[model samples]
Target chain A: MTAINPVEILLVEDNPQDVELTLRAFKKANLTNYIHVARDGAEALEFIFCEGPHAGRKIQNGPKVILLDLKLPKVDGLEVLQRIKRDPRTQMIPVVVLTSSKEQRDVVESYKLGTNSYIVKPVKFEQFIEAVQQLGLYWTLLNNPPTGGG
Target chain B: MGIDFTNNVTAGGHQVADQLAASFKEISDLRAALDEHAIVAITDPQGRITYVNDKFCAISKYSRTELLGQDHRIINSGHHPKEFIRDLWTTIARGKVWKGVIKNRAKDGTFYWVDTTIVPFLNDQGKPRQYIAIRADITARKMAEEALRQSEARLQTIVESLDEGLVVADLRGQLLHFNHAALEMHGYSSLAECRRHFQELPDTFELHAMDGTVWPVGQWPLARILRGEKLHDLEVRIRRINEAGWERVFSYGGMLVNDATGMPMMAIVTISDITERVRAAAEIRHLNTALEQRVIERTAQLEMANKELEAFSYSVSHDLRSPLRAVDGFSQAVLEDYGDQLPEEGRRYLQSIRAGAQRMGALIDDLLAFSRLSRQALERQVVNADALVRAALEELAPLQQGRRIEWRIDKLPACQCDPMLLRQVWVNLLSNALKYTRKRDPAVIEIGCQTNSGSRVFWVRDNGTGFDMQYAPKLFGVFQRLHRAEDYEGTGVGLAIVQRVIHRHGGRVWTEAQVDRGATFYFTLEEGITL
Candidate 1:
């Protein structure tokens, strides 16, 4: 699928520091792909479906992988996952949940909503870096995505 | 000695006259005696009245002329059967004497009983020519006998109709009477099987005590009553020997019945079937126990649910540490990347920022541990107290370095407790003591066990900076601190964790202290008793 301004990775996060740390960790892992950041679940859904402010973007230009933070400002991670998986236009994109909550319900619900991966943001900087690097390496480099248009 | 007229005519009339007079005197005496005691009457052939004496007329309430020509039917009370009257006539007609008791009616239409005798006089052909009937009045004795018999019949009716069983036995335990209900309770459809002596009851049916032990025949209610013991509400379980599984509980009350002269005559017992009552009582007791068990199970479930909820909230605090990680991480990044461009003061300010973030991280970690302790399942085992204390001291060895310290360690006996949690408790207490006594030139800490009221109490005494006793009540509360953070270097969650661990082991913790004097913490684990 080819489109105008196609994206490789989409980052859904509300905390700015977490975003910086995640991007830093990805860079350290040598993953320099074009990454688009959405500050909330609503903005991430808009970007995925090309709605509202993201109407100029093409739905056919879906990201290769989505890194989702569970706790978001307006729309929560589970709802955004549900919207994306329900619509065939963005369902094929792999979503990995990255949140600091180790609550069992959040993990269970994220999986139930069809999240491709779930990770608890570690407390230490080095451990967090390692967790993000491993997930980035596997989802972007190892896993293959379908090129067929929705 | 008939005073024969032929002999008188023949000769010697004067000599026969004296003998005839003596014979007449003897005959008159016999007639007088008969008239004195008996009501007498005479009947001729064909059953016609021929003669009657004054006694007969007086008893029949009739004049002599009124009874003179009447047969015995005139006084018949119609009480005896026809066959009885015919039998009397048959015996007399055959020229034999007849005797019986007869009920006869008097002339005044009243009834009377008579003891009667009839004598027959026969002719030369051996046929009865006349009949002489003699009777005596016996009405009073017969009426008394009738009243007694009617009362006995009434008593039998009452006893048979009772819902409760009544059994009467002689003093020797011989069965006198047992009513219908008594027979039914003994598992008998009829009295045939039950109509034996009380001693034979054990052969067919067995009686058991309340504890389900078979009772000897001597302990049977009948036997007890016969022994002159009065029983009240004595319960026994009974089952037929032939039908092993069938059983019933019976309540018996009885006493030894006495005759009018105060001698023991019979043993009388009353019984009631209490099988259903006993079963219902047992069922109620079982239901109560089950209800109590259900309540305990529900409470445990609620506690588990509450702990899970608390752990989740602390997990949210688990997320709080993430932001602190970023703060500490980015601050180090700033110092490592731009150290040469920043001024020395700015570098020190960044260091302070890192330190503050790290301390907040420690506080959050301690909070998580405190909540985790409440949810942790207590794993108890017998552990040596001395070892737990030494292990905690070894972990605190770094704090004890470069300091003058005196350690008074007492040998501790073994105790049953959660070894891991107890070690944590020792670490918290010893570290608190070591922290507060920093100003002391030579800090003295004592550890020992004292036997108090059969329970082992472990204590830790330290010469340290103790707070006012008024704040003792708040000492173990989470996040409650008496000393400033800069002086104490703690998050104030240590004592709360210690209290929680001790309470889970069915024990208690308390402290005694005076400001700057010293503090001694005492605790005891009484596991398996309070819980």
Candidate 2:
């Protein structure tokens, strides 16, 4: 766990199984980027704000994109989003809502809250992997985030 | 005829001076007797009181000195007209006898009645010489006559002015007296018209007795009273030709007046219209019967609706679960048995099948819950809203664990509501807030009560991804969502159930939000403790 290296993508998810599946998808897609995982909303917040355990982390260094889930232990995905999007330091970071719910409010609320993209996790593991791979390919290698002073 | 006084006196005297003496004695005796009993006075030809006896002086309340030479006018009560007095004077002037009852005034200004007779003495020329006036006291008889006349006048006024149609008839039903009210009540055109019917005793009206029996004249109210029967409030119906022959109800009562011998002399009857009273009683009875029927029908309809919901809920629980369980179990079995042999994609496909079945199972549960909420009878009790909120947070502790959620919970008031049902409301609202605010690091969910615009508003405010105020209308509908499934995990029944619970408690639910700012959902309980 290279904690000091700049994190390329922040995966804010609570389910350990989902985290494992997403990580495997990233690995199999051959996208060898430094991925930082925050198990819940609180950890994600501390990392973003450079507070608590993530005190040494800087706000300007980008995670490139955040793959967010709506359901999380402690603080939820939407709360995590509001903090990042409302702040000048982390507002420009691309946020993609990745969740298993097909609920329409989840998608609409994510986009309305400045989510860059929204994707529902497919029930089949193969489809889920394919979706995650496409997300990684597009956001990590293709999309560019607007840089700003924080 | 003129009396020959000298001839008669000579015929008696020629026989003897004793005969004249005897006649003089007898006349003197008669004069004394008249003086004792009669108020006698002798008036001159000019109507002056020449002499008055002691009886006249006593009856006139005057002394003999005052009566002597006084005119007869002195004791006149002024009751007689000038012509009447003149006639009496003329008769006396002709030496004729005049007799009449006269009212004379005493010296004390009180009146006395007298039966008076005047006789004039005639000279050789048949002219009046002296007049003798004799009177007998008649005051007691005159007073009795006046009293009888006054009593008769008073009786007539009372009989004519009475409001109730008073009809006094003989035992034979012949009318003796009928008041004006009776004439009008009978609808008679004139006294002649009423007299003909009363005298003839015609069959006047078609009438029904209280027992709904046709009444003949023999059983009529007046006839019964004549036969010595006393009746009170004997309800009867009378047919009126002016009313198109429809019968009208009347309260009839009768009493018979009896003579000293206990024989019924006259019959008195009273009639009052009771048509409106009878109709009103009937209307009230009919309306009450209709109201009872309506209540029975509505109760049956509610029972039928409840039975249908019960059947639907039962099938959803049993029949639906069997298929869902089979799908999930079989998929799980395939994944377990073919784990090493099957390709990775095939294994993943089986997992999808299992997940799909599980999702179906969850859908069924949500559907049943929504339906059951309507059928469920509410057991209302005093509920503490703050305690329920705390319990809901505890229930979602797995989601709340490790989360820095700033729950600004305030002191909540107690309200009357179903505790179990309201707790579910709290869970759904809190979880919805938690789900939508997942992206925020330090989620601030404020749960408390407020008085906004004259309402005791209970609200859950969250510093999370709020929705467009436009889409708020769809927030509480089943399966209505504004976010994608990948972002949040829900069947979209949470808010719908919350709305249902609030509505069942006779309250309303609404939200205020700005996209990406925050959301505040407010609700009001049906007349609860104020914040």
Candidate 3:
């Protein structure tokens, strides 16, 4: 991942299988924009804010959207969401919560913390594929981000 | 004795005349003084009145001119018996003086008490010559004495008749009086048997303070009152000496009684038995404490159970679904990627695997929902039943797409319930109706309400494949299905969810069905607002 070809989608998920399935779904949906995978919430934050190993990546070279999972290793998804939304440098990046939990509290908390969307990961492969693809097309190609510098 | 002046005049005429004149002057002065101070009547030896003085006339209410020769019976009041008058006469006839208090009547019939003295003047033979009766008025003193005796009798009666124990003691706390109740309180039948002094009280009875400390003699009711201390409900426990294992609770109140001159006259105390009241209050306090302890213990247990349920639900929601997702996703991956290499049976097997994973996921979700029913706070509202049924029907419209279905939705009453949960109930029951009646050429689903008393019973009747009545008991159990999965596809949790929702709203749910006949599910919400 280089700053020359700016990251467009950041998927913050800990489960390796879920990560592969999500990436496959994005490829099937024909979302050609570069997708960066951060295995946990901490790596996701580092990539978004250009810290640690990702210090060379310019913060302005944006990942247009962040796909967040609530249950993750090290730093959980909600904390990662709070940090991203609170900082002026990455606050404008759209965050969508993607998780296997249909728990009411999780949905309510995600929206309350400035999440752009919430979707429960369906058990059936087809439904999960449809959900990921629709969100990908909407955030990458359909939904517009704010123009100009903060 | 009468002076013999006229016979002795020849013997010593000059000397006798001089002495007689001197004696006459002295006697005249003494008679005037006696006339002013006393009521005098001279009675003859035969009991006839010979001379009456002005003082006597005034006391008898008779004129001197009317009673010069009248007998002494004219002023007799008849208050004295005949023997009493005879005794007085006998004393006077023997030349002695008789003194007594006589009640004499006046001419006007009003009585007067007199202190009278009768003197007999002796002749030469020492017999009665005349009787001179002298009297003094004593009416006022006698009346005052009578009034005092009557008042004392009344006070004694009042003190003795009291129900509460009354004790009167001298300032030194020496017992002077005890009413019957006071004696009974001390376990004594008479004052003679009770402790006679305050110092003896501690020996005869053990008196305890409310806090169970023994009170000494100085703290006793009599001693307290004697010290000029006013007592109110001074409660104590008393156990009489010699009466083992017998105790009574009493309330004592007292005051220092003062004489007219403001000096302490005596100490007065009142005692009342309050054993029953004290025992009842103690029992109530004990019960309250026990009840509070039980409630605290129960609440702790319930909280622990709830925490376990929450942890289980969270694990089910997160960990359980991920594996199912992997199973379904990998199965789909196999079928799609290895399609040309795999035989027909392999593809079908992969499809079954995916179907099985998805079905398991659905079951986990429904089970979580049923368990979550216990945790969800019920939010009650006035809901339009007609709107709830319509919404449920509309949500189930996808099932109605390929079929000919007639909906006979009757007018529904408004109700008080948690709208969201109640909607879940309607969805589950109506969906069951739709699913079970899938084989019908024209599925007829009827939704209506029948109000009984204050509660309205709502029912969903459908012409569908019904089951035997014997299995009706298991209809509301989780995953308790009567029909096979090949015949009617279901996880059999719809009615369980329905029953949970209805029960949470304080309502009842039941069903009526027969094999191959239509089933009607009836439910009554506890509070139904009449519309």
Candidate 4:
């Protein structure tokens, strides 16, 4: 969870395969290859808030996009999103809720918590890859996020 | 005291003789009157008949020759006992008169009641010489008296046999008569027992009207009737200290009996006990309240359970689909990354794994959707069936692209239903048609609407490999499928979802199919909705 330099994409996924697939999707898009992975919602919060083991990381040097998985082990992804959206320092950071939930309530709640994008990971790898690539490209190179990574 | 009549013949002897003759004439005339007017008869001192007058013979229905020598016993009715005859004889033998009403029998055996008197004629020695009995006919009066007794007996029998309680009271409110049932109704053993306490009926029994208002004694049935009020179906309540110790309800009918002058002389009241009916109605109300309470409790419990079930299924869909996605995704990724390095068998195995994962994913998603169909409340609106069918076909364009699907659409009517749910029904049924009809070269499929028996019917007919009729019953069940997975690529949830949605709108679904023939599925919406 430690990050001294500014990261491009922060991928918060509990499952290892999902994290790997997400990284590969970025690589295929030729988007920011410098992706940092947080295994659970708790570690994602620690990395973003610079607390616990990430105590010395500067809060301003944040990732360009935070890919948040709704289902997580420790603090729920919704709780993590709420913490970021409520905090003035991390409020402007683009948070994309990338999960395997197609539930309407989940989509609505994620958007209500200020998720920049809500995507249901498709079962087919090709579709998932395409969706992730577009998401990465849009947030990193296409869409101009706030300066200082918000 | 004048002189010896034989030696004292004088100058006035001739005159005295003439006066004596006149007195004799008077005595003979009086005897004739008695003989003609009375039923007269004479008996000797030995109680043998000496003579009978003509009047006696006619009244006794006998001839003079038959009655003259016979004693008075010939006309005796045998109704008088020996002591009665002996009393008459004793008085007559003592030279006193005996008089009594006597029943006498005639020669024809017909009887007559008579007022009789007996007198003894004395001899010079003061001994009885003969007895004479005089009688008068009184049978008409006796018959009238007997008829009155019989009439009273009949009235008593009628009053006692009645089912409803009856009470007759005088103008002064004194109970003159009460029947057997009235005693039982008053919790009394008999009329005498009721009469003992009924004198204070206003104090002994508490009375209330049918509406539970306290009723005064002056307004009671008998009292009202005494005041000449004829009432029908008058209900009242009486609180009794006996017989289950509960208040008894009764209905009474009252009538005032007037004398010949038309003045109210008596009050006749009829009462019927209605305790059982009143208590039964109360029991029904109590049972209804209890039943309603139980239903409310059961509904609340079911609602809570349903909420919990919805939550469980939501999480199951979210948690279960994630693994399937990862499996299918990584499998495809592997095949894409290193397919040439592997042998044919290895690539086939990876493809199989990917296919199985994708199937599992479809099953989980459809199952979740089917569960959501039940929990979603219906939002009924006027829905255009034609528009919904076209939209469903448009959504199925991907499946319909590669196949030669011939569409036979119709101008469908609008229905009052939830548009979203009805659209789902169309998608499921239409896609099912498209999927099952894949092998047909022409791939004939028709979507149309018809009405049968005043109900709206919609059908999706496909001319392709159809199912057996024996398995039609299981067609609409969750995860129930007749075809093999290899033959039909479905999660077995399409028809189930269709059935669920149609049922939510108060409709039903069914399918008709035969082996290797086309299948036609029909659905009916609720009746009488002006569809």
Alpha-carbon lDDT, every model: 0.83, 0.78, 0.83, 0.80
TM-score of chain A of 1: 0.78
The segments of candidate 1 whose C-alpha lies over 4 angstroms from its true place after superposition are A1-16, A22-150, B1-297, B300-304, B307-311, B335-353, B527-531
Candidate 1 structure quality by residue, lDDT tens digits, B42-106: 88877878888888888889898898778889998999999998999999999999999999898
Which parts of model 3 have CA positions greater than 4 angstroms off? A1-4, A123-150, B1-287, B527-531
lDDT of 2 by residue, B199-307 (tens): 3443466778756888776777777887778878877877754434567777777788878999766777776667788889889999999998998998999898888
Error of 1 at B66 (Å): 54
* Cα lDDT of model 4 by residue, A70-95, tens digit: 88999989999999999999999888
Q: Is the docking of candidate 2 incorrect, acceptable, medium or high quality?
A: incorrect
Pairs of residues clashing in candidate 1: none
RMSD (Å) of each candidate, 1 decimal: 17.8, 21.5, 9.8, 9.0
- Where is model 2 more than 4 Å wrong at Cα? A1-150, B1-245, B251-277, B280-284, B452-454, B528-531
Clashes counted in candidate 3 amount to 0
The iRMS of model 2 comes to 9.8
Better of 1 and 3 by DockQ: 3
Docking class of 3: acceptable
Interface RMSD of each: 2.7, 9.8, 1.3, 1.8
